[model samples]
Target: MDALMAAFVAAALAQVGDRPAWLAAILADRYRAPGLVIAMAALALLGAGLLAAAAGAVLAPRLTPEAKQLFLALALLFHGGGALFPVKAPERLDRWRIGAAATSLAGLFILAFGDGVQFVVLALAARADLPWLAAAGATLGSLAVIVPAAVLGERGWTALPLVPMRRIIGALFVVAALWLGLDALRLI
Candidate 1:
């Protein structure tokens, strides 16, 4: 349960103002199929989470608790920094040649493959022994953010202070990194 909650909160925070939400909004507008877009995106996220969680499970046994703490700290720092300075998403798929749902699944899967949330799930699962729970939680966290973006589009996302929010989240990540690193070193 702790692993589940940790993955959920971490993934949710990592996803804000991120490409998944923007991608959802774009797909919704271009395809006029919010339900399909949201559903496909969620599935894509689930796939990514499961893959990462499995990788994490593989790594967990080889890592000591201190090593896990250090890895988690590094992951937080890396993702937080990425959030604070985001890159533009790929051009929107103006034409859904393969049908809206299929296009959404492919596009989102490709795009979301390397998302911060996936890596966070990897790190969190590596910290704990519950990979499936972590994967499920990460998937839900992504849906929680992306669904609203698909539904509300610009009216919701543009209203938010994205830059400031990213920085704040980034700051939180740095703080966590510091704490974890200190603990790993037995200096805290």
Candidate 2:
């Protein structure tokens, strides 16, 4: 479905060089448990996606299609603008008494909460009235990026041209937002 693919591609693009990916790389390097880090990261992303999708679904029936489009446009604009800013460094969780796996899960989940990707997932789900599909797509898309970060560790991850990738993706989101906004306003 359009919603699913849109969520997937958008989340994947938005995730590059983001804090969550950095956290994944840091955890993989620190714990020397890339598998555990990847698994925890997937779980965290899935949880966040489901929560966002659910919120979007709850609003689906309340709005007209044009209103949903407007809302989604706004969300995309926010995501695009935020992507232009450099992400803050991921925090080290050295003091947690929990094992590496639990720490990873908690840290990743905390970092993902209310992030730009989640906002896009929420908007897409509402627009398409396909919350579960959007959530699944977002989870899978996020994993596609996070897995490499976990496998690569910090040094390898740092070598990526994440800044340029992020800028391009941000520009794409802005273009999509503008188009959608125009359509929603019946000016296109």
Candidate 3:
């Protein structure tokens, strides 16, 4: 559906040079267990997506369509603008008493909370009234980025042109946000 695809693309673009991808690389490198790291990351993304979608669903019936559109536009604008900045690498959770698996799961889940991708998922879910579908798309999109980063490790991941990708996506999101905001206001 339109909601699913939109969330997928938005999440994928938002994550290009974001903290999650870098965190995935750091976890993979530290554990040398890329599979576990990837799986844990996937679970974390799924959890975050579900929470976002739930919040979106809760707001859908309460807000007018125009209000929802405006909210979505704002979310997109915030995400896009944030994507323009370079993300510093996140610290590894070495202090956790849990083993690597638990640490990864908790760390990734915590990192994903309130992330730009999740905000996009929340907006799309509310706008489309398709909470589960939007969440699924977002989770998959996040995996698409983190899987590669996990497999490649830190050095290989750094080799990718993430900065350029982030800036380009950020600019595109900003443009889309402006257009959508105008439409929501019936200004164009």
Name the regions of candidate 3 deviating beyond 4 angstroms: none
User: What's the lDDT for candidate 2?
Assistant: 0.89
* Residue-by-residue lDDT tens digits, candidate 3, 2-68: 7888888888888898888888888899899999999999899999999999999998999899998
Tens-digit per-residue lDDT, 1-188, candidate 1: 87799888888887788888888888887777888899999899889888998999999999999998888888888888777785576668776589888888988887778777777788889988677888989888888888888887755765777678877888898788889889999998
Assess candidate 1 and give its TM-score to the true structure: 0.93
lDDT by residue (tens digit), candidate 2, 1-188: 88889888888888888888989999999999999999998899989999999999998999899999998998899999888887788897878879998999999999888578898888889987568888888888888889999899989998999988888888888999999999999999
Q: CA lDDT, every prediction?
A: 0.83, 0.89, 0.89
Alpha-carbon RMSD, candidate 1? 1.5
Q: For each candidate, what TM-score against the reference?
A: 0.93, 0.96, 0.96
RMSD of each: 1.5, 1.0, 1.0
- State how far residue 132 of model 2 sits from its true place (Å): 0.8
